[model samples]
Target: MARNIAFGRIQEDMNKTSFFKILADEDLSSESMRLIPNEFWRSSECKILPPKVTLKVAWGSSWPVNLSPFMGCYLMERKGWEEFLNDNHLGDNEFLTFTNEGNNCITVDIFQKNCVEILKPLNTSSSNVKNEEMSCVDPVIAESNKRKVDSNVYGASSSSSSAATFSLTIKKSHLTLLSIPVTFAKEHMPKVRTKFVIHDPKGKPWEVVYVPSNGSKLFSSGWRFLANGYGLAVGDLCTFRLVRPKEMVLEVLHDSP
Candidate 1:
């Protein structure tokens, strides 16, 4: 069987933009959609406009649409763009990432929250505890020691290690399948596709796949089962610890209504 590469990147020639917020009234409705204000097209280095392109959603779906530079902003033309919005149920205040795939093909990823919420220290001492019994014994001391160990082993730049720990605020869609940011995954995970284990707060283990998102990959599998098994919901706060290259530990900081 062909190895299923988890994620891939768009061609370098494609024009890409940072994640941008969707205007409440303008982006979701039938009104014409405007590209986020940026030098993406305005920069002297980027002047060519592709007449036609495809829009691929990370979740799964693609649409062919026309592109036109209008009044210093790029506008998406054709009814297909509207249909894409409706199909995705995109609304105001959400976030979308756009990547032009050359040949008029653009890929998009939707984010329920405009920004990924940083994980705060649930408790300073027990913050890095990997064992339950030890954490319960002396959380303060355990946390202090963990910090020292992390400092010695992983150093100050947390990004340098294969392991990572962070928190995310759950969204409605996350209830079905949590979305891991490409930036986070790229930093802590192996480049190739693989299945990893997630240990919930209760110390139960579940298997999830780590798919890299170069440009085409969307939410693959493994996370939803974990979320549903734990009955996760929107507004909940989830803490994740990438314990090893293929193992993670999860904890629910707060459950949602």
Candidate 2:
């Protein structure tokens, strides 16, 4: 069944502004935050905000076990909720807390008006799912689909879209490879080299090398990828891919092993 992600509700007045785009604040908006329509929360926009509780750091696994502080926050939609609770509740500072009792912390931020939602089971569950997805190849494909690949290899006012096709190829039981196209310069250009670093779901690192080349080798040296896209960098993760293949081909493959 298709799932409908409802963001909750937004005041009618704020709903008309197109300035609101739901995304991680760090990636898209330099501004810490901006007001969003309550409907944005109802339509999957809720994820854009910080969780009410989060684990900043932790250690050990047992009793007296070294654990980080647990952080917490109280959320409010508007002045009314604050009046009811008798606290200065504004969706202003992105609040975060630490606890001596546990290995996690809490963060609280409001999503919309009149609603005080806690990101408990939902936050934990989603983090688990994201971790699992990151470990596998799924996230990479999703990233590629969502982000356009462009590079400034050529001296143009704008970057051109990569024309090469990308696909997953697995050889050994534990190895994965990503095939992508690379374009070469028309005139006698100096051979160059670049590198691509793939990151796993846990933010682990994997690196691959690509070398620039010309002639038949350029076409044959499809850049090899060692892992699926899930473990690789996405649109906002890193700035560029660097590699130079032995043969001059306008393509690079990311290989996983």
Candidate 3:
């Protein structure tokens, strides 16, 4: 087995912006890539073949200084290739770490503008893309309906209809299989850890949840299976209504002391 190797370099040519351009324009192959720590590749004891495309790997910020064009494509694909991103790969200023466990560990610390690409092995045959749907109840309509029913007991004239009052058109392309956001209002923050509710003009509602970031801001935009089954039309209106903050109903065991 070839021993793992580590390398780093400051390449003015290898920044994030430029890397993507190279990835899109270049057709990389295993033979064209350089195996670093020169001695590791020269070792006759370990028969580690060069990485194949579609390898599953984790990339932090650092690694063998420069990544091959094939490695760059691996990152783009592994990371969902979505440009709608918010940097979330690093836990802190720590250098990006890439590891191919049982094979080799590659670490690098490029300038912030450039990122190191790590190669990971994966089975592509099993990872098929499927069309799923998303469905969730709308918060605004749920609350409004509850209030109207409550007011009826007091003989108050509840003129408000069950149908929603205000709704904005949402594009189908904006929603994913996980009910995630493709594009959303930058100003609106979904009440901390909660989903975004969409109330329709008819007072119907839908919900889209957020997947917590795992050292990476990039997320697979997906919606619930149930919701997607119900066809969504472009230009259809939806509303987001604020709900009361979720609170613990029971006291913690430690609180009694």
Best-performing candidate as measured by lDDT: 1
Worst 10 residues of 3 by lDDT: 246-255
RMSD of each: 20.5, 19.9, 22.0
Worst 10 residues of 1 by lDDT: 1-10
N/CA/C clash count, model 3:
33
192 in model 1: Cα distance from truth in Å?
A: 11
**Cα deviation of 21, candidate 1, in Å:** 2.5
Instruction: Say which prediction, candidate 2 or candidate 3, comes out ahead on TM-score.
Output: 3
Q: For residues 41-82, could you state the per-residue lDDT of candidate 3 as single tens digits?
A: 232233743342121122111122223334333222223222
TM-score of each: 0.36, 0.19, 0.21
Q: Is candidate 1 or candidate 2 better by lDDT?
A: 1
- How many clashing residue pairs appear in each of the predictions shown? 10, 57, 33
Off by over 4 Å in 3: 1-166, 177-208, 211-222, 246-257
